[model samples]
Structures are given as C-alpha cells and as structure tokens.
Target: MNENENISVLFKIVVVLIIVGAIFGTFMSIVNFALIRSISNEISTLNNLTISSMNDRMNRMDSDISSLESNIQPGGIVDEYINAYNFLSNTNLDLEKLLTFASETPDATYLTVYIAGRSNVWITVTNNGQSLLQADLKPGLSDYVFFISGNPNVKTSYTIMLAPSSIITTSDASATYILLAQNGKTSILHTKSPSLSVSNILK
Candidate 1:
C-alpha cells in the first residue's frame, strides 16, 4: 500500500475509537442518573408510609381515651383505668401491688385523682367492686398525665404521675386507688365501664 493511503486509514481508525469511548461514557452517565432518581423516589414513598402509620395509631388511641372517659364514675374504679390503659397501650400493666402503695403518695400532681359520690367505683369482676381512682371526680372531667421525668420516651425513664385528693370527701381525707402490678411493674388503671366487682363478672 502507498504510505499516504496507510496514513489516512490510521487517522480514520483513531477517530472511530474516540467516538466509541464518548458514546459509552454518555450511556453510563444516563444509567447512573436514572438509578439515583429511582432510589430517591423509593425513600420518599417509605417516609410517607411511615407517617401514615403513625397517624393511624394516634387516632386509635384518641378514640379509646374518649370511651374510657364516658365511663368514669363520681368516685372512679381503679382497676378499670388500668384495663383501659392496657387496652390502649397494648401493654400488660399491673396496678395491683401499686394500688397497695398508692396511699403512700398524697396530694401529688396526677398523683391525686378524684371522682364524686361513689361515681368512680366500678366492678372488676362479677361482684368485686373498687373505686376507679378517686372520689369527687366530676363527670366529663378530663385528666392530663404530664411527664415528670422529661423522658417518657426512654423505656427506663417514663415515671408515671399520681394525683392527690384522689377520692376526696372520704372520711379520712384519704383516697383509694386500684394499683395494678404487671410483670413486676405497678400502675394506676382507668376504665370507661369497668366492672364494679369480680362478682359483676359475666361468668
């Protein structure tokens, strides 16, 4: 072959190689960008799903709280309150032993619950009746449980509050509460329509 023809052929080959490299790089860039966008979209969808679940849980809890309030007695049934909490939190919280010690704290915030005239009493079982939380608790009265430890979120840090004046108008100026002790933990239970006594149980 003539030297001039050979040189021209070589030049054409180099140009073709450069074009191929550019095409390959453009294809890879497009693929990478698409993959990144897909990942971002997936994250957004997951976040939305998470938010929706949280909202549903909150709504359920609110409804349960309302139902319990409607059943509060003038006095209050302690065990019933605990049952309501367990129903809402889905935690097996015991308030029995805690009830035995409830009298230890008197006149404390959320520490003292009150209902009126035996209105707070409820039946836990067929004939086993007990006060809800306190006497002198007005009908439709709303009670708020404030976080005292500033860490109701930390499993080991959530400290429950007690309301004093619980069951006011009692002869001793002392109130009674139904303590629930579950899994070695004690708490006050509330109820909407708690059975007044074990005897009140429906067989």
Candidate 2:
C-alpha cells in the first residue's frame, strides 16, 4: 500500500483507541461514584445505630437512678436501732446477758424470748455452747427479754433445756423454747421429753 493509505489507517486506529479509552474512563467514574455513595450510606447507618444504642443506655441509666431514689428511706437504719434499744431498755434485766442471748439466735435481727418454768425448775439457756442464763425459775410469769443487732445479717441460735427439782430430776426435762423475730413474729415450741411436768404445769 501507499504511504497515504498507511497514514489514514494509522489515524483511524488512534481515533478508535481514544474513543475506547473515553468510554472506559466514564464507566470507571460511574463505578467509583456508586461505590462512594454505598460506603457513605453504610457509614451513616452505622453512626445512627451507634447513636441509638447510646441513647438506650442513657435511658436505662436514668431508670436505675430513679429506682434508687425511690427506694431510699431516710433514717431507716437508725429507726431499727432505736426499736432494738427501746425493747432492751424495757426489760430492766442484765443488758449484757440479754444481748448475749439475743446474739445467739440464728437468722434473726431482734428477738424477745419468754420462757416460763411453771414450777421450781432449773433453767439453762445456752448459745453456741456458751451459757447465757443458768438459774432456777419459779412458777408464774417469767421475765425474759432480749435485744439483738437490728441488722438482719447478724445471726445465731440458742438451746434452752429445763430440769425438775432435785427431788424429781430426769434425764430429759420438759422445756418451752420461744423465738421472736424482729418483725414481732413468734414461734413457740413446747418440748415433750422424759417428763411432761413443765408443759402440764404451764398449760
């Protein structure tokens, strides 16, 4: 072929390459724009979710604070202590012994124990193997009271056993054990043992 023909062919080739490159560039730009928009939307959605989570946590915190405020009682602990003190003061007994006996009862805050011998009986009250009251109680109303820690967490248990007079002693003696809780709840137990003298007399 002649030089002019070759030159025309070369010009056509260059023009076609330019058109292809322009089309490719446009497609790439469109793809890049779409990717950027998708990335921006995802970021925006993540940000909104984070904000919503933060707001929910803040609301929960506010609710907790409100609950705490509502439950706060003024001088509640002081009132418990005062009640215990008044109960103890009324007994007019050895405060130390009464307090010790109260300390021995288990799962209790405060207690008022009343034990009546109903006869000339030996009264032995022990707490954790330690003697609290070991005396002879006569018939009629027995004046036994106690005051423990007003705090419910403080706890102990006691054992009260009774024996008859020297003339009528027995291995197992009749006993009356009473447990009074701080809330004025009473639980009385009349033990039936080798002798029913105490229960019969008290009844």
Candidate 3:
C-alpha cells in the first residue's frame, strides 16, 4: 500500500477504537445505574412493608389491651394505664401527652403499669349461677398487687398495702428509665420505672 493510504487506514482505526470505547463506557454506566436503582427500590419497598406491618400489629395489640381494660372495675389506676397505653400506641407524636404522662417533676407515686404478660389471671365468678369475670395474680382468690418498684417483676413477694407516696411508673414506652430508690434502711440502691406517675397510691 501507498504511504498515504496506510496513514489514512491507521487514523480511521484509531477513530473507530475511540468511538467503540465511548459506546462501551456509556453502556456500562447505564447498566450500573439501573442495577443501583433496582437495589435501592427493593430496599425501600421492603422497609416500607416492614414498617407498615409493625404498625398494624401494634394497632391490633392495642385493641386487645383496650378490650381487657374495658373489663376493669370502672375506677382504678387501670384507667391511668389505659391513658398511658393510648399515649404509647399513637403515631402522631403527642409531646404534650407523653411529657405529662411521664412527668415526675413533683415526685413519684405508687401503682405501676406493666406489660400484659403472665401478670393477668382470668377468673370466673358465679353468684346464683350468674357469671362474672375477674382477673388476679392467680386463678384463685389472690390480691393483684399494683405496687411500683424499680423493676415491675420484683422477685420478692409483697402484699399490696395502702402506702402514701410509693414510687410508681409505667411501661409506656420501649425504653427503660433508670431509677434510684431508698427503702429507709440506710441502703442505697437504684431501680428503673417504665413511666412516671404521682407518689400516692391506694392498694
């Protein structure tokens, strides 16, 4: 081949290689972007589904607790517990309600509300064959002590006493609050409250 033809051929080949490289680069960038977008979308959808499912489960559980609370004997600190539960289940952050419910600026009180676990014992009362439902610590006639302690489930068994200004709190939220309490025996110890309440409670 002539020198001119050879030079022209080399130039054309170089140009073609540059164009091919650009096309390949553009294709790889588009593929990478699509993969990233797909992964991000999948993650977002999964997160949304999980959150929505959790909220639904919480709502159902709140309904069950409300049903059980409705069976309470009208006037008890149980109403206060229901209030605390309402504060817990709501999504629209009621700062005022939560602060008020958890407020302990004045002092602590007696009567603690705990999560509904084995603490409840369903009972059936019959008066002249008329059935009345009552719940307690046991299926038998045992007092359901609603006392406040650092821990809701204090291993020590104590009967409910009408104590004035006994420390109280509630498990209104998931987070546990640390508490320091003294039982007047020159012993200093700390406990935690689920939520805050007044200091006076009648057993």
Candidate 4:
C-alpha cells in the first residue's frame, strides 16, 4: 500500500479508539449517578423511620406522665382524709377493748404498756387497795416489768389498771400493750386512732 493510504488507515483507527473511550466514560458516569441517587434515597428513608420512632416514644412518655399526675391528685386513688379516719377508729376500738379486759381479769398484773407518740401518760397498779408500782412512759416507747404475787407459795389475786388519760385523736398513729401472767400466759393489745375530721368525712 502507498504511504497516504497507510496514513488514512491509522487516522481511522485513532478516531474509532476516541469514540469508544467517550462512550465508556459516559456509561461509567451514568452508573455512578444512579448509585448515588439510590444511596441518597435509602438515607432519606432511614432518617424518616428514625424520626417516626422518636415521636412515638415521646407520645408514650407524655401519656405515662399524665396518668401518674392523675393518680396523685385530690380524690384520686389515695385519699389522705379517709386513711386518717380509719386509723383513728381502729386504734380507739383496740384500746377500749384492752382497757376493759385488763380491768375485769382476775389476778391481773400490769406488765407493760405502750403509748404511741405520747410521753405524758403513765400507769398505776393496785392490789388489795395498796399501790404496787407507778411507771412513767415516753412517747413512742415500750417498757415491761416482772410481777410476783403477794404470796410466793400461792397465786394471789391482784388488780391492774391505767390512770384516766386523754385519748389520741390523731391519725396514722398506734400504741401496743403487753401483759404477762405468772403462769406464762401472755396478752398483747394495740390501739390506733385516725384524725377526727378525716374519719367524719369518710362517713
């Protein structure tokens, strides 16, 4: 072949190579753009799901807070006045029964008396018209004593009793008393009193 013909063949080969290179570059650019768009879409979807989950959690928390607030309000599940009344009535009944039993029992000895939150009360024991013991009690305090009958060889009859003291009208308070007999018998008493107004309101 002549030199011009060879030169023309070389030019055609160079042009074909340039066209192939441009086509390949365009295809790669398109693929890259498609991949970037898919990734962006996925990221947006993930962000939306995360925000929705956070909002749901916030709404649940708000509901829980509201329920708690309602439970603690006045006339809710817990009533302070009613609780006080029940406490006082139950305590007074217990105390009355304990006093009556102690007074009527034969050979009774005042072993111990507990007054809840009252330091000014005390007890006195008398047998055959003679004073046996005088004990001082503190508020919210418990104390005990051992008693022996007048005759060690015989079971002596005695009287055990408490002095006239003011009753407790407060709520959420209680007292306990314990009595021990020479023959190893035991009696326990408890008294609780609630606030008068609170009790009255419930009724």
Q: Write the per-residue lDDT of candidate 1 for residues 60-156, one digit (tens) a residue.
A: 9999887677657443465456444433342223234224334332332122222222234321111112333333333222131222122222222
| Sort by TM-score, top down from the best | 4, 2, 1, 3
Q: What is the alpha-carbon lDDT for the whole of candidate 1?
A: 0.40
Question: Candidate 1: TM-score?
Answer: 0.34
Model 1 ranges with Cα > 4 A deviation: 62-203
Instruction: Give each model's whole-structure lDDT.
Output: 0.40, 0.49, 0.42, 0.49
1 against 4, candidate with superior TM-score: 4
Residue pairs clashing, model 3: 108-198, 108-199, 109-198, 109-199, 165-199, 170-194, 170-195
Model 4, 1-203: lDDT tens per residue? 99999999999999999999899999999999999999999999999999999999999999998887777664445444443454455447456644543443346333444454333445444444455555555543233333333222232343323322212232223433334332334454343333222112112
lDDT rank order: 2, 4, 3, 1
Give me the displacement of residue 72 in model 2, in angstroms: 3.7
**Poorly placed runs, candidate 2 (over 4 Å):** 73-203
Kindly state the number of residue pairs that clash in model 1.
Answer: 76
Which stretch of 10 consecutive residues in model 3 shows the poorest summed lDDT? Answer: 184-193
| Highest-scoring model, lDDT | 2
Q: Per-candidate TM vs. native?
A: 0.34, 0.39, 0.33, 0.40
